[model samples]
Target: MDQTTLLLFIAATFVVAGFVKGVIGLGLPTIAVGILGVVMAPAQAAALLVIPNLVTNSWQLSGPKLKAIALRLWPMLAGTCLGTWAGAGLLEKAKDGSATLWLGVALVLYALVGLKAAKLRVPAAHEAWLGPVVGVLTGVSTAATGVFVLPAVPYLQALGFEKEELVQALGLSFIVSTVALAFGLIGAGALDWTIAGASLLALLPALAGMGVGQAIRQRISAATFKLCFFAGLLALGCYLVLRAMG
Candidate 1:
């Protein structure tokens, strides 16, 4: 694609991604990375995600239980940082398209789980050990696929937080993941000034889309929209997998 075309494509992609997040309260990174992977390496797409994800998730850090949540989730967050750092070069090293393949697989699994809407409860006794393990796994996945919603999201859901708390926890985790991923990308030499600037520009369309999505949420059924979203994700995942294979 030409320069103008690429710019337009990126803007449109973020708009759609932001819309998804506004309606569902998550998915900006997943949607943006998955779609951008169609035109570039996962590492490059992930670099573009840093600014948008960080800025958007920062607002989610607010809430009364922020300190408690941080204290409770510190081990997991620490593990994410360590694991991401350790695996920071995976995407850059996977030069034979394996990174793209794994990205597709991650999207497919995430979409499937969302479609199933499975409910799992993690006993408090296991959390101490399990949280860090899940964090490491999530970080590794983020390093490899530029997406971090698999085990992390599921494990968080199983933590038994109330509705508001869960939302806040997710935002917190995403912020940590985004920051960790940014460092990982930088270490891999994938993030730089040009990509950072482009990511910043992408933020405007993303925020605009979020506004529109929030407006639409009041008029439509979230459950119905979620179903469609997962369905679309599944298709997109399949396409990515097939394209990578070909």
Candidate 2:
């Protein structure tokens, strides 16, 4: 495909993905990776996703509940940095390993669990160790698999947090993962200026979709929102598996 057509298609996907994440607090990678995987390497997909992730989560961070979430989730953020570093390192160094399959499986499982979890709420308190564990998985996934945002969501949901709290947590987690993944991708020499430009261009759609998402938030039932989110995850997983098989 030509550059303009590819960019338009990618932009449309970004809008939908942002809308979904705006409404649902997840699906940034599920949407970006699933579609972009067909057209680019996983590294490119990740690079394309970085700015949008930053922008979307930055909006989410302004919520009134954001401070509380920051206080509660700092451990996880710290842990994510370490976990991501380790995970990214292993993927980078392990010559025989295929991180793509791991990413696919995680995406499918996350969708399944998250879909079921939409009925519940985010927890007020979660395990201290959970952050580092999920963070590592998330980081490694991004470095090797391109979907590092997965490990944080289901567990956070099971913790029974408020809706806004949940959104902020997911948003924050993705932003953190994006940072780690950017570093990993950079260290691996996979970052690109053209793709970074594309990601920046996506900021408008990201914000626009977030506006739609916020508007839809009141109307969205947790079950329906989760169902759509998980469905996207499943579809993305299948696509990843197929790509690996190919």
Candidate 3:
């Protein structure tokens, strides 16, 4: 794609991704990375997501129980950082479209889990050991595919946090994931000034889209939107997988 077209594509993709995030409390990086993966390497797409993901997720961190959530989730957060560091350069080094293939697989699995509406419950006793395990898996996936939703989201949901607290927990986890992924990308020499600037510029439209989504959130059926979101993700994931294989 030419420069102008690429720029337009990036902008439009972020708008839609941001809107999804606003309504659902997550998916900016997943949607942006998956769509951008069609035209660019996963590492490059991940670089473009750093700023937007960080800023948007940071916005979601405002809540009364922030400290409590942080305290409760520290093990997982630390594990994510360590796992991401260990997995650094995987995407950059992937050969034969492997990164794209894995990205597609990640999306497909995530979509299926969401579509299934699994109501897993994590007993408090097991959280101490299980959280870090899930975090490590999530971090490794993020390092390879530029997506971090897998077991992390599911695990967080299983914790049975109330609605607002769950949102805050997701925000905190995403913030850590974004920062960890950014560092990983930087270590791999994938992120630089140009990508950072473009990512920063993408933030405006993202925020705008978020505003529109938030405005409509009260009026729309979240369950219906979620159904469509997962369905789209499933289709997109299959397409990416086939494209990679072909």
Candidate 4:
């Protein structure tokens, strides 16, 4: 394919990905990779998500929100760093089925455990493990099943965060994942100029989508959001399995 065509396609995909993320606060990587994986390798698809995720979420930084939650998420961030380092080696050795198979398994358990967990009020000290857990998965899967971060939300709510604080936390996590992912990809020598340029250009669509998503989020209820998000993720997981199997 020509440069223009590839650019157009990626831009379109990024826009949709950004919209989902903008509205739901967590679909950028999940939606983008599912589509990009159809055309590119998972590694390449991952490279595209890094910068955009960082850029969009960074725009969300309110003074009090950043100050308050960034401190609380410190433990999780440290865990994320460690998890990124450790998970990189395993990711290199891990083959096709590992992520999709486990993600499917994780999804089932998420349905069972996560439902109960989301309803309870858990303290931060108790659920602190979520960061490293999310980081390891994000690092390895390149954000494929990075929705692992989503489950941590219930625990955050249990800790009694308002909507803005919750949004900030999720946005900040995306920033951290983007940075960790950048380093991981660089170590793997996945950071060529062609991909970098493409990724930079792709941000335009991502920004546009984020605008649309922010607007949509207001119309949806939390339960409806979770249900729709789960259904979308299930379909994504199934598609990944088929791709790996084929």
Best-fitting candidate, measured by lDDT?
3
TM-score of each: 0.98, 0.83, 0.98, 0.79
Model 4, 1-246: lDDT tens per residue? 688898788899999889877776776776786677666665677777767877877865665768868877776666665666555533333456454554444454444443444456655666567655644544444433433344444444566777788777777766776787667666766666777887787888999988987888888786676676667666666666666666
Ranking by lDDT: 3, 1, 2, 4
Query: Worst lDDT window (10 residues) for model 3?
Result: 208-217
> Each model's RMSD to truth, in Å?
0.9, 3.2, 0.9, 3.5
Winner by TM-score between candidate 4 and candidate 3: 3
Q: Runs in model 3 with CA error above 4 Å?
A: none
Q: Write the per-residue lDDT of candidate 2 for residues 63-87, one digit (tens) a residue.
A: 8877878777777777777766665
Model 2 bad stretches (over 4 Å): 63-68, 89-99, 118-126, 219-222
TM-score of decoy 4: 0.79
Model 4 collision count: 2
TM-score of 1: 0.98
Against the reference, the lDDT scores of all candidates come to 0.89, 0.71, 0.92, 0.65
